[model samples]
Target: MYPFLRLAKEFYVHRNDPALPLTGTHVSHHLCWPWDLDLWMELNNGRTLTLLDLGRLPLARRVGLIAVMKSQGWGLTMAGVSVRYRRRVRMFDRFHTRSRCIGWDERFIYIEQGMWRGGECCNHALYRAAVTDANGIVTPDRVMRAMGLDVASPPLPGWVSAWIEAEAKRPWPPMAE
Candidate 1:
């Protein structure tokens, strides 16, 4: 199993503001395609370390990370994503991306991620993950249990929780809207 704490720490370290400049443009230019792993690979300069790479960072490792977090009695999920790109990453460019747990609530967890190349910000993304099940139903407690964590009523950080609540209220644009 993957170590959740270590992954979480690594993710957190890469979060930043997407509107910032990377190279010459704002990070928004890099997000033209969402599910393109090739673009991600290119961004990393023919190397591996893209979001898909991170997502596939050994399922066992991710499961272990989730297990550790659940053991702490915290709720989390992988819900939705919003990414903005600033510039096109070319071959041989070395970049870094960070993810951070901004907050959470009864239904979702809010994460902020940022990508940088050579000290310039390249991309920024906000992810909203649902605390749900395979059927896509909200069940934070059950999800926690599935990870082998004993449930607790521990208080969450104010900023983290508040961010989730605020994000939950935003109206998501429809696919054809």
Candidate 2:
């Protein structure tokens, strides 16, 4: 289950945080609860993705994205992601999460996030996100303008652009056996 209660706590705790620029990083802390683990006793690969919401939402709040979303009646959605899991995260373990918007293209915004324990990174992920309304996607430039920021998007990094290109070439519907 999604941690809606924890998400609410994050919102309340960060309500007073100052607004951030597009490239600013939002750092937060979290724990791997018993329920977050798999049969093997480490954090489940799927659950790791869900837990990332706790970090990303707070980052959005700090950057004033939530305010814009609310005022414009827009919703955020994760269109895609590429993630790598490294070290194991055991139950009751504490970790620090770092999340930020790297940049955007015509269709989606890109965010980079990592989970770290001690000085080592346990996971890293890049998310392709989109803002939506009753109609469809609201472009990132328009979304930024709603937050009173300029409409210019920083250039996407080479890796991100390559991923976008790769995804473009990938087949959509799977072939029948």
Candidate 3:
């Protein structure tokens, strides 16, 4: 089940919060409920992605991106992601998440986030997200302007640039056929 109620409550709690800078991190705390577990008695891989939404949405809010989306009738979606799960998180365990926008390319924005327990990271992820309009994907520069930021984007991290380069070499449409 989706955490609709939890998201709604979080919306109110962080509603009045001021927007964050492009690189600022939004930290959120969570508990692994019984429903969040898998048959193995640990967090499910699918549910991990779903729960990430709980952190990311608040991040979008803190960055004032949601407001811009609402005003422009835009939508947001993840284009890609690379996540690593290093340890198991069992039910009733408490953890905190840290999410931030790392940088952007011509077509996508990159975000990095992590789940930590007692200062140890159990999982981390890098994501490519796109802002969409009726026409299709919106450029990052356009989005920056909408957010009232006139500054140029920061340089892409070495790892991010490498990933982009790697993606370009990957064969599209699949090789299964």
Candidate 4:
């Protein structure tokens, strides 16, 4: 299950939130439901990624990305992601997620997100996302313009830049053993 109801609840909860600048952080709270657990009785890795969406989508809404996409007939898609998990989230445990756009390049936007419990980070993820329309991928410049912003992207953090560089060198379709 994709938790559509929870997403709707989140939208309702933050409907009145102030609009955020391109890089402003949006934070959302969540609980670890029993169904979100794996065999070890902690949050499953895949579920963590799915749960992070609860934060990411709200961030997109707060920043007006969703509205722009809808109006421009553009779709938002994740091109790549890297995640780190450092702590356990047992059933019923409460946590908060923080999400923000780190920066963008000509073709892609980079987002940073983290899950925290009791003021400690439990996991973090970096996402490479794209905006697309009928032709193909839409440039970040056009996306920004649609959102009524004319500013340039802040420089991408070193780690995110490194990841982009490394991904460039990786063989597509991957190599067979």
Clashing residue pairs for model 3: none
Q: Best by lDDT, which number?
A: 4
lDDT of every predicted structure (CA atoms)? 0.47, 0.90, 0.90, 0.95
Poorest stretch of ten by lDDT in candidate 3: 9-18
Rate residue 9 of model 4 by lDDT. Answer: 91
Query: lDDT score, residue 158, model 4?
Result: 88
> Sorted on lDDT, highest at the top, how do the candidates line up?
4, 2, 3, 1
* lDDT tens per residue, model 4, 67-159: 999998999899999999999999999999999998999999999999999989999999999999999999999999999999898988888
Of 3 and 4, the candidate ranking higher by lDDT: 4
Candidate 3 local lDDT, 1-177, one digit each (tens): 888987886677778877788779988888999999999999998889888888899999899899999999999999888899998999999998899999898899998989999979999989899999999999999999999898776898899889888888988977986
The TM-score between candidate 2 and the true structure equals 0.96
Work out the TM-score per prediction: 0.46, 0.96, 0.95, 0.98
lDDT of 1 by residue, 90-147 (tens): 5555555554544444655455666776677766666666654445655545545565
CA lDDT of 136 in candidate 3?
A: 97
Worst 10 contiguous positions by lDDT, candidate 4: 151-160
Error of 3 at 128 (Å): 0.2
Off by over 4 Å in 1: 1-65, 68-77, 141-177
lDDT of 2 by residue, 1-177 (tens): 888988898788777878778779988888899989999999999999988998899998888888889988999999999999999999999998899999988889999999999999999999999999999999888887798877577888899999999999988886777
